[model samples]
Target: MEEETDTEEEKLLKRQRRERKELQAKIQGMKNAVPKNDKKRRKQLTEDVARLEAEMDERHQQEVEHLRLEISKQVEVESLANGIGKLECEDGEKTAQHSRPTKAQKRRDKKAALEKEREERIAEAEIENLSGVRHLENQKLGHVLAGRGLQIKQIPSDGHCMYRAVEDQLKERGSMLTLAQLRSQTAQYMQGHVDDFLPFLITPSTGDVYTPEEFEKYCDDIVNTPAWGGQLELRALSHILQTPIEVVQADSSPIVVGEEYSSKPVILVYMRHAYGLGEHYNSVEELKDRTTEIG
Candidate 1:
């Protein structure tokens, strides 16, 4: 029975590890699809990873607790039987002393202690890896831009960074669209094509699909408020402008939205941690000279 229980515990741990590995692979795929410099996306991913780990740990704890209880009951039964035999042999004059822990119990306790230590080490290593990735991405962004003879043109960290970056790109192409105009047009486009955009609109508080009314309010926020723009807004802008929008980030190749609209693409740099605030976008301009410092 002890060996059988040990085998079950080992199987449970292996299954847990496999599930975690699959989840991490899925998260990495998501990271690849989007810009790595998206602070919000990275934060969301981190939270998801942490949540998953916590859940797995909780489940393992519960299972171990259950197993411990079963073992304790078995030990009590065996000790009771042994006590009866000793009492009978001594003709009821003496009682049985408490039994020492079995070899199997000692081995199980040691294994559990070692497993906990391993988990703690793994968690610490994961935290360090996340920090290292953030630092490496910052350095890689500079190298990526320099290789292309382009440099980041800083945009204000206001909620309108995406629009402002687009505005800067439009100006270079002799288009005089202000950020306000871009915001308004993007909102209007999304409103007119509700079928296309409404499905993607989610109510953050409920984590549910947005109702038509909620979707309208979202569009209103886009036009009137300083709500940050993201992939959805980028898609609307790309369609409205009839141009492809290319987003360059540190850890991945450029992500181009609306490629079918035009061969020429307006480019923007995505910074994960450039400003201390959060995710941000900036315009890219040609390097004045090789001597120009990469910001």
Candidate 2:
């Protein structure tokens, strides 16, 4: 009968601890869901959580007191014998081991959590650093180009910068051509004139010449994916638009890649050692004629 009573008391204590844990979880959920801007709702949630916390604390105190009283009764029944006292102390130590984390365990858990947070912050800082670099590079380019009668308009840096820059230049010239359409047209031109591009499209990774199959796959990526453009795409676009493509670099003279076989003229502005990376292109436009007009 005594053993059965002890088992029932242990089960009751376990249930009380489980209930307290559940209450703690609910309180945390309510706190998170309550928005700071909603003053009335936030206050209501705060009060509810506080009330639940108070009840949990009171229950915990009652359980602790009950356990103390039971231990005292057992001590008296055993006539304060050393064996009974040692057994009780051992049981108490076991309970402490199960319920409380050791200092070293707590430190390890805290260290792991802090390491994860540091990695997340570092990732964010890297992205911000890249953006700042791009912004500074643009300012420097604008300062140099303003001396001439031109300034560069920034385009989206998503591997599609080349296509977007060309599109921007065309838009200024009163033509509305989407990047996708231009990509498709350029791919078709290259496919029709394989001999011109096939030699250059040699597999860079393997140092082997491009097979007809590999060339087709590469063309597909240019048209469908967000792959970047290079001299080859510029040449294809020039042929398709039937215009000369002029790229003005920072260190060298203007590099004209396509023939001026048609009436349309396209000028591309490029900056070397820009954005702390490779060369990048921007759309060039002429400022309004201010030589004759007075301020």
Candidate 3:
């Protein structure tokens, strides 16, 4: 009887343990099953925490860098800029009179002064004394035509003279012949006379001005050959002579550069009288009236 009782008790204990395990599993599953909406909320919270951490790290780094830079800037015995009177001089001239400005500020001030000075000087140009290249017969800017023709009063040979070509072309073509046309024709004729030029004068960079050999070689290239044709564009030549060159509108005599005035342009011949290389005048109107004599 006792054995049967003991077996019964064992069976009862097993059943209770199984029920406890099932109850525990049910409670765990209930806890794990979250609402669908809460999952997104938890994920957003995690992401926000991570982002805030990153921003805080970045802010800390920026603060550290700012402090370090401030310290370095404050530590300098010498200037950080180079443009104005330098912190250390090459000539070793020390100035006790001048108050020390930051290197950058000093440079900016110095630049402003220099630009102001240049403007003042340009503004103060003595137009009366300004003149063109001294042509023989002391050709003033206002010389009248006598049909005597241009001769090599200066430079190269009398035969290779450009002054005559200019005069001849000007007289026949009228004073309105564009500067570019004159440059082109002058080069074309000169190269025609000298047949040995190698590289053609299709593009006129500052390639051969100082040397005679390069000049002759280029002369033969562009102008010497009858096979090349009558004349490479004469107007192109005149435009090439002036660096930082300006052109005037056909309707107006206003000086125009890259963006000083209009952007759209019809490339016309450079009018020689347009630029006052021969004289000085502040305005184009001054150039027209006071600068040149029509007679």
Candidate 4:
């Protein structure tokens, strides 16, 4: 009986897995058929995919419940076959003859424990996969840029990476500005335009708006310390230099800042895992010839 029950459970699980694989393949095909630029179609595709995934999850839950019920019925039958019964005492109270857990109960407990362990392993793997995904994205960005006759000129992994990349691009345009000078100018520009940048400056730890004094200190750090630069600083730099800046990434189209300033924008590549030291930026330069070897 136990062997028959095991065979049935295995068959059901195998069939469900096969169905899930086919559904996933169909969804992927649907996504591949849609063009990336068609925002409406892509949005609709996203909704459809989400709906399908939810349905699959619900179906999987139902199958699990069904299997649990089947196991419970089998356990009850096995217990009855083992002569499980109750005895009446002198006080007319009934007491179970068996004091220890039955074999079927132990099997059910073991299965539940194994399922919980598998879930925990999956959760841990997902956390590790975040970094893995970023690494893969950086590689994809390299391939995309290579196809466009451009290559990433790696910048140092220091906190001044953004400024350094900007400085490198500016040099190609005949603007000889030191990293320190660029930092100072960016800091000064933000300090002068507090109303523009302050609204976005929320304290990460407290999740509150920064006081005027805090904002001032932030600007000061941009100049005097190795503070990291972000989108706000990029905007400020674009305006200060009076040149449009383009940030390219793997997952999306290039983002143009200060587009009003110039038609020819300075290109910078944003990377998540290129340097292994957190978010970094690299300068983009055109290849000299079509025959140039690319890695």
The Cα RMSD of model 2 versus the native structure comes to: 30.0
Residue 21's lDDT in candidate 2:
84
Better of 2 and 3 by TM-score: 2
Backbone clashes for every candidate come to 0, 0, 7, 0
What TM-score should be assigned to candidate 3? Answer: 0.20
Q: Per-residue lDDT tens digits of candidate 2, residues 118-151?
A: 6567546644765776677566655555666676
- The model with the greater lDDT, 2 or 4, is 4
- Model 1: per-residue lDDT, tens digit, 1-295? 1344334445554565676687678767876876778988887775455444433433444454565568679879989998997778676444545545689989998998998687667556655665676677767876788878887888997668889999999999999899899999999999999987776555434647779998889889888977777777888899988999998988778878798985589999887655421467899898767774555
Model 4 C-alpha RMSD vs. true structure (Å) is 17.2
lDDT of each: 0.74, 0.69, 0.35, 0.75
Clashing pairs in 3: 150-164, 180-235, 180-238, 197-217, 197-220, 197-221, 198-217
lDDT of 1 at 242: 91
In order, what is each prediction's RMSD in angstroms? Answer: 16.6, 30.0, 39.8, 17.2
Leading candidate by TM-score: 1
**Winner by lDDT:** 4
Off by over 4 Å in 2: 1-104, 113-136, 262-264, 271-280, 287-295
Model 1: CA > 4 A from native: 1-135, 291-295
Answer with 3 or 4, whichever has the higher lDDT. Answer: 4
